[model samples]
Target: MAKIPATIVTGFLGAGKTTLIRHMLSNAKGRRIALIINEFGDLGVDGDLLKGCGDATCTDDDIMELSNGCICCTVAEDFVPTMEKLLARDLPPDHIVIETSGLALPQPLVRAFNWPGLSTRVTVDGVVTVVDGKAVSEGRFAVDVAAVDRQRRADENLDHETPLSELFDDQIACADMIVVNKSDLMESEEADHLAAVLKADARRGVQVIRTAMGALPVEILLGQKIGAEADLGARHEVHHHHHHDDDGDHTHEDEHDHDHHHDHDDFESFVVTMGEIADPTAFAERVADTIRQHDILRLKGFAAVTGKPLRLTLQAVGPRIETYFDKPHAGPRETRLVVIGQAGLDRAAISAALTA
Candidate 1:
């Protein structure tokens, strides 16, 4: 009974965890893999994204989804049983890749592996922390970290122990390896600066790899014997705890936190469907224009483009829309689009743009 290797990929919102996982699945050398997609949102959108990699090698039953809003709040309730079932399978996967929600914490989830019932057959290959390369270069994680310092004086009970910024630090601290994702989007100098910051701030001595959405050799991410279990003790020592709440109140746990709203950041969403959309480029531009007008967080769905041999898929994260030919539909299914955002969601405006 060989212990199965499990890899955990954790990152903030839009950091490209799904992209890297999809790439790995598509290019894997005939390894039977199982993917567990946990989304911050209530909808199973992230799971669908991984499935769109459109690879036949991955069995349909192998792909599983758990949409419990946020992993931080639901790890015990949702993750435990899920792991039990995965291990209980007679034909368990050779490898298991879990893409946790953007707002997820790696520590608690990793601790579950130590839980009583799961020790014999499973072991963490490693925990990989994914960071947004472009944003890391610009210093989004610590842009105003000291600002948090000053505000703490005003209120003593502030959850100064788990703020999202400090929470991100904890994720990096616990990583067996750090992947600076979206590396192609940054300049060499920018990448170097981010590397320096990461090396200096990392909880333990860890290696940082410059990768395009964590798209490195599968070998690097899998079978990493960083002795994550042994290092877990040291990692906990340097947690640098702060409040997870941005509002300075401990009331961060909310039901809709996973719903595209993400702390009232103003996300908007609308749905549009039709039989055909020939010009994907033109249609994508229209979607972008609509996003520019509103604070759109995510856009998804499939489209049947005319004059094309395959289905033109649509996916947008923030200002970026990644489109490509997935596979052709066997029967007639209209091009359905769902635009989601917290800032600028206008159904009429987006509908006109798509139909225009």
Candidate 2:
């Protein structure tokens, strides 16, 4: 039997990973695709959104959610068994797509493929990293360009980095391909420049494609045949240091304590639920205001609207909100969203404000 090819989709929060996967499943071209989605928060909002996509190639049964924790941290307990079950199916899928948590590091998850049973059955087709072009353009991750230019004129070596930038760099370093998504929010020249900068930073021969709304064809995204796991030595990690035993079990060696969950100590996420919303526009504005007020990084979920048949989907990245009705209300007439941001979030105040 031929080994199954699995594509790993990774990126920061709100980088449009779900959107890109939806596009791939919609245009799967008669191929059966199985999805393994990992989410940061308690609620599985990403899985819920993708399930409503109504793509035949990727039905609800084909979608598996690992909301317990980050996939990398729970590989032994969550991921390995999931893959074994899928591979044991009477009619296994033609391809598998794993969407890592936005806060996840792809290297560890990629390394999981080398485990005993999975090693012979599956090959990593590619690791695609999605970049938020709009956020990058606004200097959300890296140091300010103006400050860098000033230091350069002073003949000073720039050596400033943020936690978010370190995470972004790790993602870029392990990627087989990088997609600069949401380019529509940027000027044509600015988008091209961003892509150029990313390409320069990335490993040799990696393609950086700029896109709006995560729009990319299936051919361009898949079929890389990279077998990334076999070349793990080439991909460097900025945040984690791991050593594997002879049995293939891996352990982390870092400054943080033994608890690996603390790797993301800088970030946190929580869910907010409320009754039906009266006005969609006003509700979105309220949500946006709450985001701005709380310094929330990413907020997304569905809202049950008054006198509306379809469910309202709201997604906000840094106070820039987008809302639209996706499908009809399925189970309940209530609003639910997952709020993510840096640690020390004012959850009590945010919940009160959004539900108000």
Each prediction's total of clashing residue pairs, residues at least 3 apart in sequence or on different chains, is 23, 0
Q: TM-score for every candidate vs. truth?
A: 0.60, 0.62
Q: Candidate 1's C-alpha lDDT?
A: 0.64
Give, for candidate 1, the lowest lDDT window spanning 10 residues.
248-257
Global Cα RMSD, each model: 16.2, 17.9
Candidate 1, residue 93: Cα displacement in angstroms equals 0.9
Evaluated at residue 338, the lDDT of candidate 1 is 81
Question: lDDT values of the candidates?
Answer: 0.64, 0.75
- Per-residue CA lDDT of model 1 for 1-356, tens digit only, reads 77787888886655667666766787677787888877543356666656666786466687887765444445567877788788889877888888776555677666667767766667777788888777667767422444434444344533544555666777787786777876667887888688778867875446566665445655445656443554567666234333432212111111101212112122235578777876788888987777666545457778888887788887764446778889987778578888764334567766776678
The reply for model 1, stretches above 4 Å from the true place, is: 72-76, 142-163, 203-205, 237-356
Q: Supply the global lDDT for candidate 2.
A: 0.75
